[model samples]
Target: MDRPSVRRLPRGRHALPPERVARAQRDRLMTAMAEVMSEKGYVKTSVEDVLKRAVISRQSYYQHFTSKLDCFMAAFQRSTALLERQIVEAAAGAGGPVERFDRAVTCFLETLVSDPATARLCVTEVYAAGPEALEHRTAFQQRLGDHVADILEAGTEAGRFTCRLIVAATATMVSGPLLQGDHDALRSLGPRLVAHVRDLKAAGLL
Candidate 1:
């Protein structure tokens, strides 16, 4: 997916509701936070940087988030939620389990590559946000792993464990390539990763 635009409203808006206006500004701030964090890393990013890119006022930023980390988590959660939805929707399509699994994995990697800024926030920079981010990451991994288990009809505990392994290994593979800016290599790994899951299942592992 493309990055969300840092769009603006007319100088004197007329018809848009208050809630709509609030959501638009929040989206811009989150988009700016993702992009700025991608470029500068979490430690180096400041509230001013986000406000600058978002073209939003400091007062507006405070209405939604208390700190830069709060903004970062908001963006992280939003981006990952979208990514998860894409995966689930892909897996829900017309196909057998393996095909659905492949579709979901392909969508996952393609999403990461298509929007590197958000990908960086979701994949790499979350680690820099401390314990709250770490807990969220763990929960995300477990939920995603469970999705994979569901795709494979893995009702047993062992099957779920194997799925967890798959998600962890897949994350490792993509993270290195993503951090290196090797987007082609990152996209190419999707098929191989899917194939690994197939191999594991074929061996009666999952």
Candidate 2:
């Protein structure tokens, strides 16, 4: 009798078992990449440095990512995800839209002050990392801006606030002082922020 022919799996339908190991290595590398970037900036960090920090071989690095920029993008996304969660959490459970909006701003500013290095990298490194990084950063900013706008729109619809400005303008107005290094003004203006929300609530704009 003729031997039966062996069957082969279709391409791309199943991943190699090694893919899981590769993913684990990639995650560790991304963590190390963020630490290096946060401490040294992208321009100053080398592939070898990342490899050393991650304790992975050069072959393993390339197996998981195409280039340093790829890893940096992953790290950038991770950092932004954490920031977004914090902002959302800070805004959570507020009495009204305006209060929630103010809390979001406060959370963002506090994040900046607390993690200045990471903040600096997020704000300053995009341009230096070239177009791809810039695009990623821009996307993140736009998403955050959209969220801010949503909050403002909610406030407006609820009669908790009155503003003719667009969402972009409203978001900028809400966050401008904090981003522009006017923390003292923000601190002094804290009561005003709260009052603004209160007034909105009282006016039924919230």
Candidate 3:
């Protein structure tokens, strides 16, 4: 008997494993969600719109997300995580806590200005995403605040800054406005935002 020849996949084309396919679908859905939400507010963006944009089947969308809200949250969370990483990286090389804080704030403002869609998704749609989404947003904001508090604590220890910091409150005060501001607004507010941190040091507010 002659041995059968296996059919090889064409160049740049092959069946992906289940995990890869799933991951790809999730990413596509999230990307489409972001674009659609940016164009239409979260409340108006339908799952059908996202599916059409992503070119994914309803069954595939359901496999990854339970609802449009779930998909929006997923996109928001991922974008926030990326923003966090960008801030961390930008601040990493600064000379000290104050400088690090300044660098981080600048990067954040620049990012928001440069990527209005992401800023809108994070600061605007997040509020309108309903109760659970608000909860997630609040939690992430608190986490960001904690990070700022750590920087303030380090600065205080070094005698570069003073005051006891209510980390979450301070973080919200700093980030809330910047995140919600438009491109031109954030660009103009950059200096003020930095000054706000400096004032925190001056006032011994940490």
lDDT of all predictions, in order shown?
A: 0.89, 0.64, 0.69
lDDT (0-100) at residue 192 of candidate 1?
A: 86
Which 10-residue window in model 3 sums to the lowest lDDT? 1-10
Decreasing TM-score order of the candidates = 1, 3, 2
The segments of candidate 3 whose C-alpha lies over 4 angstroms from its true place after superposition are: 1-13, 154-182
Models sorted by lDDT, best on top = 1, 3, 2
lDDT by residue for model 1 over 1-206, one digit each (tens)?
A: 65577898667748989998999999999999998888999999999999999999999999999999899999989988888888998899687777889998889988888888998898889999999998998899899999999998776899899888889888888898888889899889878877887887788877
The residue-by-residue lDDT of candidate 3 on 52-80, one tens digit each, is: 88888899899999999889888888888
Top candidate when judged by TM-score against the true structure = 1
Query: Which numbered prediction scores highest in lDDT against the true structure?
Result: 1
The residue pairs found clashing in candidate 1 are: none
TM-score, cand. 1:
0.95
By lDDT, the better pick of 1 and 3 is: 1
1-206: candidate 2 lDDT, tens digit per residue: 01111222234655567666566677778777765766777899888988888778899889878998988887677678888788777767746566677787677656665654455556655557899988887677767765655665544443322332332343344354534556665455545655765675566564
